[model samples]
Target chain A: MIYLDHNATTPVSPQVLQAMMPFFQERFGNASSFCRIGRIARTALEEARASVAACIHASPDEIVFTGSGTEADNLALRGVCRAFHGRKRHVVTSAIEHHAVLKTCEDLEEQGIAVTRLPVDCRGMVDPDQVKNSLTPHTVLISIMAANNETGVIQPIASISRIARSRGILFHTDAVQAFGKIPVSVDDLGIDLMTLSAHKIYGPKGIGALYVRKGSAMAPILTGGSHERGKRAGTENIAAIAGFAQAAELAEKHLAEEAVRLAALRDAFEKEVVQRIARARVNGRDAPRVPNTSSLSFASVDGESVLLHLDLKGICASTGSACATGSPEPSHVMRAMGLSPMDAQSTIRFSLGRDTSQGDLDFTVGVLADAISKLRHISSTA
Target chain B: MAKERGDRDDTGMSSAENEKAQPIQGPVLFYNDTVIDHFTNPRNVGEMEPGEANGYALVGDPACGDQMKLWIRVDSGRITDIRFKSFGCPGAIATSSMATCMARGKTLEEAAELTDDDVVRALGGIPEDKKHCSLLGIMALQKAIDDYLLGRMCAEEGDDLS
Candidate 1:
C-alpha cells in the first residue's frame, strides 16, 4: 500500500533497524546492571542518548528517555507543575496542541492548577503577543507545539520562547511533528523543555525523549527506580532507544535536502488537486507549514467517505486528525482556522514522507480526483 | 468496504456507463426525485432580517463546531414562511431544506413533533454517520417553535402585568 500518513508514523529505516537488532538479541543485558554485558549495554544506551541529543542541538545530559512522546509531555507538564507546587499554579498553551499536551494541561486544570488555552488565528498560528498576554503572575509553564500534526502549520516557537523568557516562565514545545521534518534546535529556540517521539521520525515506537535543559527545575512524574535521573521510572527499552538515535541522526543529516524535495512534491500534489478538481482547496494555505504535509478540503464531499474511497483506490490518507478519526466531530484545527463546519469535515490530510516519489503523487492525485468526482456525483443525485 | 463494481475502458467509461444506462428497477420510494431536487438546489437559504421574523432560534454549538440559525414566520399559529442558515455539512443543508418543507403550513404542535428520523426519511435515508446533521435541524426547528410559543405567552403575561 502507498503510505501517505507518515506524519502519524513511519516505517523504520534499514539502518535504524540494523543498529537496533543487536540490543534486542545478544546484547540484551539490562543497562542498569553492573556486569560486563550490562556495562556494554549502558555505554551503548548513553551513546544513543548523545546521538539523540545531537539531533536537536541539546546537551547529552539534558535528554531524558521515556516510553512515548505522551509520557514526555506528561513528564514535562506535571513535572514542572510539581516543581512549582506552591509558587506558580498556572500553565498556558495553545488551542491546536496535540492531545499529549492538551490533555496534560486539562489534567493539570483538574488538579486545581489554573490553565489558560491560547487560541490560534485563521492560519492555525498562535501569536507570540497572545502568549505574552495570557501570562499571569501564577503562570509557571508555557507549552506550545512546534508544528501542528493535522494542518502542519509551524508555530513561532523562538518568538514565543523569547516572550516566555522575558517573564521568567519555563517554555516547553511538543516537537513530535517538527523534530525530523524540520530543524529543531533547543538552543536556538530558547526552549527550556521539548518533546520528541521516535515513531514519527522513522524510529521504532514506544521510545521517545524529553529534552530538559540542565538547571531547569522539574520534579519527577514517575516514582520508583531512579532510571532517567529519577524522572521516568521504567527500565529503558534499549533497542528502540538505539533505533531512535540512529533515525534522529539520519534525519538531522538529511533534513535540508529532504525538506526541499518533500515540499516540492507536497506543493505539486496540492496544486494538481486544486487545479484539476473544482471546489478543492488547501487548508492552512497561507500559513508556514511543514514541508511534507498538505491538508486539502473538497467542498460538498464528506471527508470520511472520501477517505474510504481513497482507501479503496489503494491510496492511504487521513480524514482530519488521526487521533480523532473515529469521532464524528469535525477537526478542531480546521474549525479554529475559521473554516465552515462543512469545510472542516470535508478536509483530508496527505503527509508525504522521505520515501514518497513522483509516481506516488501522480497516483494519489488521480485517485483523489476520481473519488471526489464520484462522491460529488453521488451526493448530487442523492 | 464498498466494492468497485465495474471496469474502465480506454475512454475511462465502460461497463459502468452501461450500468448507468440501465433503468433502475425499483419503486419510487423515499427519494423520488423531489428530495434529490431539493438537496441539489436548496431553497430558503441565506440570512433573514432578525426582528422581521415571527420567531427565530439559533441552535447548535461552536464547541460542537456546527450551528444552525432557523427562522419562521407564523401567521395565525401556522408556519407561513421558513428559512435557515446552517454552518454545517451538506447533510445538514439538506436536512434544513427538508425540515423547512415539512414545517411550512403545519401547526406549531405538528412542527414541534417533527423527529430527525422524519427528515432522514424525506431524504431517502441519510448515511448513519450523517444522521446527526438531520437531528440538529429537527432540534433547531423545535426550538424555534418553542421560542414562538414562549414569546406569545410572555406577551399575554405582560398584558396582565399592565
Candidate 2:
C-alpha cells in the first residue's frame, strides 16, 4: 500500500531496525547501572543523545529523552510553569498547536495559571505580532509549533523567537512534524525548548526528546531517580534511543534532497487535482509549508468516503473528517483556519514519505479522479 | 423489499463499482460487508427528474457534514418508486440506500412508519458512533411522505401549488 499519512506516524526504516537489533539482544543492560554491561549501555545512551543533539544544533547535556512527543511537550510546559510558579503565572500559545500542547495548557489553566491561546490566520500561520501582543508582564513562556500537523503550514518561528527573546520569555516549539522533513536548528530559530518524536522521522515509536537550552530555568516534570540529568525519570529505552539516533542522522543526510523531491511531487499532484476535479482546491495552497503535505478539500463530498475508496484501491491516506477517528468535531486546525464546518469535514491530508514516487502519485491521481467523480455523482449537491 | 436482494432492477450500481468493491475487505476497520456493499454499490443512488417526483425532502445540516435528499413518486395512495442522494459518510450512504429499499412498493401509510432502527437493524449493525447517520435517510423519507400528503391536500382543495 502507498502510505501518504506520514504526519500521523511512520514505520521504522530498515537501517534503524538493523541498528537497534543488537541493543535488544546482546547489549541489553540498564543505563543506570555502573558495571561493565551498564557502562556499555551508558556509553551508548550518551552517544545517542549526542546524535539527537547534533541534528538540532544543541549540546548533549541539554537533550532529555522522554517517552513520546506528548511527554516532551508536557515536560516543557509543566516543567517551566512549575519552576516559575507565582512569579510568572501566564503562558502564551497558538490555538492550532497539537493537542498535547493544547491539553497541557488546559491543565495549567486548571491549576490557576492563565493561558492566552493566540489565533492563527486563515492559512494557519500564527502571526508573530499577535504573539507579542498577547504577552503580559507575568507571561513566562510562549509556545508555538514549527509547522502544523494537518495543513503543514510553517509558522513564523524565527520572528516569534525574536519577540520572545526580547521579552526574556522562554520559547518552546512542538517540532514533531517539522523535524526530519525540514531543516530545524535550535540556534538558528532561537528555540529554548523543542519537542522531537522519533516515530515521525522513521525511527521507532515510544522515543522522543526535548531540547532544553543551557541555563533555561526548567524543573523536572517527572520526578524520580536522576535520569536525563534530573529532567526526566525512568530507565532509558536504549534500543529505541539508538534507533532514533540512526534515524536522525539519516534524515539529516537526505533532508535537502528529499525536500526538493517531495515538493515537486506534492505540487505536481495538486496541479493534476485542479485540472481533473471540479470544485477541488488545496487548503494551504499559498502558504509557506513543509514539502511533503497536501490538505485537499473537495466541495460537496465527504472526506471519509474518499478515504475509504482510496483504502479499497490499495492507497492509504487520512482525513480531518469526523466519525472516522471517533471525534464528533472536524479538525480544530481547520476550524482555526476559518474553514466552514462543511469545508473542514471535506479535508483530506496526504503526506508523502521517502518511499512515495511519481508512479504512485500518478496512479493515486487517476483513482482519485474516479473516487471524486463517483461520490459527487452520488451527492445531491452535484 | 428486505430479503429480495439482487432481484430489483433499479440498484444504480454498475459493473465498474462491483469490480472496484470485489476485493476481499477485512472487517478489522470500517463497516461490515453489508454496509460496504451498499456504500460501494448503492441502490436507487440517483435523483429524480425535476417534475417526475411528486414528493421530495432534504435532511441533515451541512454544518453536521451529513445531508440527504430523497424523492418519491406516489400512485393511487401507494408508494411506487423512491430515490435518494447523500453528501455523507459510508453509513449515511448505506443507510440511505437501505431506507429506499425498505420504502418502495409499501403503501404511503406503511412507508411513513419506517424508522431509523429498522434500517440500521437490517444492516446487521453500524458502528456505535455512526448509528446517528442512519437517522438522516429515514428522516428524509418521512419528510418526503409528508410532502406527498401535503401536496395531495393542496390539489384536493383546488389550490394549484407550484
- CA lDDT scores, all candidates in order: 0.83, 0.88
Candidate 1 colliding pairs, count: 0
Docking class of 2: medium
Alpha-carbon lDDT of model 2: 0.88
Model 2 per-residue lDDT at A79: 95
**Ten residues in sequence with the least summed lDDT for candidate 1 chain A:** A373-382
Candidate 2's residue-wise lDDT over A98-213, tens digit each? 89999999999999999999988888889888998899999999999999888899999999999999999999999999999889999999999999999989999999999999
**Poorest 10 consecutive residues by lDDT, candidate 2 chain A:** A320-329
Number of the top-ranking candidate, with DockQ as the measure = 2
- In terms of docking quality, model 1 is incorrect
Interface RMSD of each: 7.1, 1.6
TM-score of chain B of 1: 0.73
